[model samples]
Target: MRYLPLEEITEDMCLARPIFNGDGRVLLSNGVKLSKNYVSRLKEMGYQNLYVYRVGEEISDFSTPISDQTMREAIHGVKDAFGKAAQRQQLNIRDVNEIVSYILDEILTNPNVLYNLMDIKNHDNYYYHHSVNVCIISTLIAKEMGLAREKVKDLTTGALLHDLGMVCVDPRILSQPRKLTEDEMATVREHTNYGFQLLRSERNLSILVAHTAYQHHERMDGSGYPKGLVGEDIHLFGRIVAVADSYETMTSGRVYRKAMWSHEAIRQLRESAPEKYDPDVVAAMERSIAFYPVGSVVVLNTHEEAVVVDVNAKKITIQFSSGPRVNALMDLEPDSEIKIEERLS
Candidate 1:
């Protein structure tokens, strides 16, 4: 299966994976044959791309660390909690902690899961979806860095609540299709302080979690907002969440811009490491994310196109252009010349 732009879709193309609604209900199920009508409907609903099966393309299960049920639950939980935060009302701290704990449990259970951010997003639920995605990516990065169990939990909790301040921002500013004005940009940047104040009010919560919301926007070069903290001054949780936030924001499409490819986002992170972002954190994230995720169609150096079926320790399993499958390291030793040339959209 391969990701195709909506305009590229034709009749009789089958969906490789199910698309879910904001409520996590199946909008369209896998293996469903598509028609022009179906494509038009999805386009009307704001879907720009889809995963469809190509002839002779091998289907692979794209596993995530958490289940869809858990994802929906977390999204709902964030929506409720963040709404309360925006109002300056006391949050159900216990409930929020429990939800974070549950997510941590799932990540810990699937310690080696190669994270793929494939959650369906809509305009109304972007903030909720983004928070959950950032939390997952941050936790996986912490795991990759070999952080202690307790530290991992703290980082995960902090990551989940990092964007709490966005709730206070005006929807009009966020939804603006054009670039924000200087004044509007300043107001948008105040979310960090807003979120920090809200989270810091909960005495039962860790101060680090509040700091996560506060310092996530800070840059290592003292160019970040609010405090403009320099390297080593930024808390570990803050740095981790910052990297996750950057990645999720880049990959998750917004009204103002198209979503970037995974490899491109990773490359941006790598290039900015130790300057705009923490080098160690960027490295951890790079190791955690799949460069060429499952179902992605890639052209090899040999001029053959294939779909990545699975990624393993030292190599990836791919269904070659010839229709046969092979488990070979696409970038090393014997298969050194067979590098991935480009990832198809």
Candidate 2:
């Protein structure tokens, strides 16, 4: 499905998927016919765009970054570097450094576009999709933290390589859909050190960037692995990545569970246990995340459905097929009669 802006949502476009509100309730059934109220409600809610579920490639590639091909090329290009980095008996920091450099080049050259491209990382190719999601999560966090453009590039690079050490591990462990045993989890935790050691051999890469790959999984509460250093000791880049990593991991679709809606996902991060992540970072990440991101379908609590068309200075205003735009995305306090239903996959 393609996302349609609220202004662009017409009676003509069809609903290919069911839509729901944050409460896990269905608001619109699939195949429901469209109406004028759909547009009105969506606009009232401030959802800028609507997703057209069943579309051709022509529509799918209609985005700003226009870098799917470029990204695919880069993804494969870096795969070779990762292979080289992984094969050495001793860590080869050069590979990690090159990998990070390439990623930074991509982000710096096209920040605004790729920056926005994060919203659409759900396409095929999990590896590339993973890269895109990491970029989105990291960029959002960095931007909200008020980092300068150059620093944004550095964080983006760190995020792209944060999992480089994982590439050295067995694919079976990384791709497993179920929970891992303690032993398996231990092996899984090796990525941090392995990544750091590998990057240690490289040249000119900043310690901050290298540390991101190694320490991102390390938590603030010291519940993390590979030398579970607690808060403050964890590098700033590492800390930034921790929130970004979890945000991407929990919110995105997995073999085990459906991807949670962005709003719900933020709520989970806010309410979750151990206080493993920094609370401030969580809040920044939430504001940066596109809860009702442009071009996703949503249903209201009023039994009305809309497609998010635009992001206002505040709320996500949805363009509905039958309802009016709600006043605020933050005021998610279920309007007894109005609410968002579902996030289109």
Alpha carbon deviation, residue 302, candidate 2 (Å): 4.7
Candidate 2: lDDT of 197? 81
lDDT value, residue 64 of candidate 2: 32
Across 54-161, the per-residue lDDT of candidate 2 in tens digits comes to: 322112222233244345444554455466666764334464445445555544444333222223222223444465457556766666677776766667767766
Q: Which prediction has the highest TM-score against the true structure? A: 1
Quote each prediction's TM-score: 0.89, 0.67
In angstroms, how far off is 58's CA in candidate 2?
12
Candidate 1 C-alpha error for residue 337, in Å: 5.9
- Cα error of candidate 2 at position 251, Å: 1.8
Worst 10 residues of 2 by lDDT: 55-64
Residue 64 Cα positional deviation in candidate 1, in Å, after optimal superposition: 1.6
Q: What clash count goes with each model? A: 0, 54
